[model samples]
Target: MELEVTLLGTGVGIPHSGRAQAGLVVRAEEPLLFDCGAGALLRLAEAGLSPLEIDVVLLTHLHLDHVSDLLALAKARWLMGANEISVFGPDGTEAWFEALRSLYPYLEELDVSITIVRPGDEFSLSGLMIRAGEAVHSLPALGYRIESEAMAAVYSGDTEPAASMRKLARGADLLIHECSFPEPFVVTNHSTPLWLGGTFRGAGVKRIVLTHLYPQTVGREEEMVRDVRAGLADETKVEVGRDLQRIGV
Candidate 1:
């Protein structure tokens, strides 16, 4: 089966002209949405896709920047007469969705199934194998490793250096990690070049795409990539991700 990822949105909570909030569309077996943060629908449309084409959404966490558009997707699909959506996310996900429905009573009319997942959970959807990894974020969060055939890719949400992330990315074809800052500005929960570089050390990831970029990284993209490259072994491709970039897996 073919596997590819379209970075629908790559910006952080703070807005940037060329970037949007965190989101991705992974085409594997079927179209799966990784996250649906604010402005995700706009980017998806710009990438020539429709919410009706997506039926499964795998959320890494419940952070607003990662899930703001969660209801928007369901509403769009409902309006388009698409299939009912199934959502999988870390613990408290069901509760979060329940609360969202309370505020938007109209969404309660849509059919959305929410499945709560935890770290270390392994499951299958269609032909793809997926595993969840714990992330070292401020709150409980998860990272995902998705494998299809012999190809594998890991998407690590906003996090700091975590051993679980390293284990998940080991020998993977692609690692999409968050690089929230360039350097010198120490951060917790979020990742910087130094923190992100440390997480990649010895992980054996073939290619690294940096996303969830904050405005601070606007001018220092090259330096950020350079710093992370220092921690990875030679031959590992590293690049700062941009919105709407499509990556093959």
Candidate 2:
């Protein structure tokens, strides 16, 4: 099976040019969408994909910047004559979807199934094995490790540097991590490159691509990569993710 990851949007909650909110697509037998943030639909279209093509949507958390596109994708897929899409998320997912449905009565017309997951849960989505793990964030968040026959990838969704993330990313072909700010930003729920490097130091992952960049990191891309490299071993490849960038898993 061919596994490829496309970064739809790399920005965080704050608005920034050239980067939308956090969203990514993992293309395999059936494309799986991860974190459909604000501009996900638009970016997906730009990536030469249709909203209806996504059969599975995996949400890491309920933050607006990470899940705002769920409703948008639902409506768009409905209009495009698609019937249902399975959505997987943390404990509050059902309640959050219900709240959104209450706000928009038309959402009731869309056929969507919600699955609530917990840490350490493992499931199969379109031939890919996915394992959920805890993410150190303010809300109940999850980081996922996805494995196929040919490759493996892990996504750190809106998390601070944590041991769980390191374990989940172990031996992954690629690690799509969040680099929300530069060094010494002093934040609890988010990660800075300087703080993350120590955590990823000596990690076995083959490559690491930093995403979810905030405006604070606009001009410090090189510096951020350098800091991450400083914490990692000499051979672990690190790169800053750009919108629409695609890499094989």
lDDT on C-alpha atoms for all candidate structures: 0.88, 0.91
TM-score to native of every candidate shown = 0.96, 0.98
Q: Model 1 off-target regions past 4 Å?
A: none
Quality of model 1 by C-alpha lDDT: 0.88
Put down candidate 1 lDDT per residue, 1-249, tens digits, no spaces: 668899988899999888899999888767888989999988989988888888899999989999999888888888888648899998889888888788977666777788888889999985899999999997789999999888999999888868999998899999999989888888889888866887677778899999999998988999998988876646688999989999997
Clash count (model 1, backbone only): 0
- Stretch of 10 with least lDDT, candidate 1: 227-236
RMSD vs true structure, all candidates: 1.2, 0.9
**Residue 103, candidate 1: C-alpha displacement in angstroms:** 2.4
In candidate 2, the residue pairs with backbone N, CA or C atoms under 3 Å apart (3 or more residues apart, or in different chains) clash, namely: none
* lDDT (Cα, 0-100) at 66 in candidate 2: 93
Question: Candidate 2 lDDT, tens digit per residue, 1-249?
Answer: 779999999998899999999999999888999999999889999999998799789999999999998888888888888878899999999999888878988668777899998989999998999999899999999999999987889999999999999999888899999989988688998898878888977778899999999999989999999999887746888899999999987
Candidate 2 global CA lDDT score: 0.91
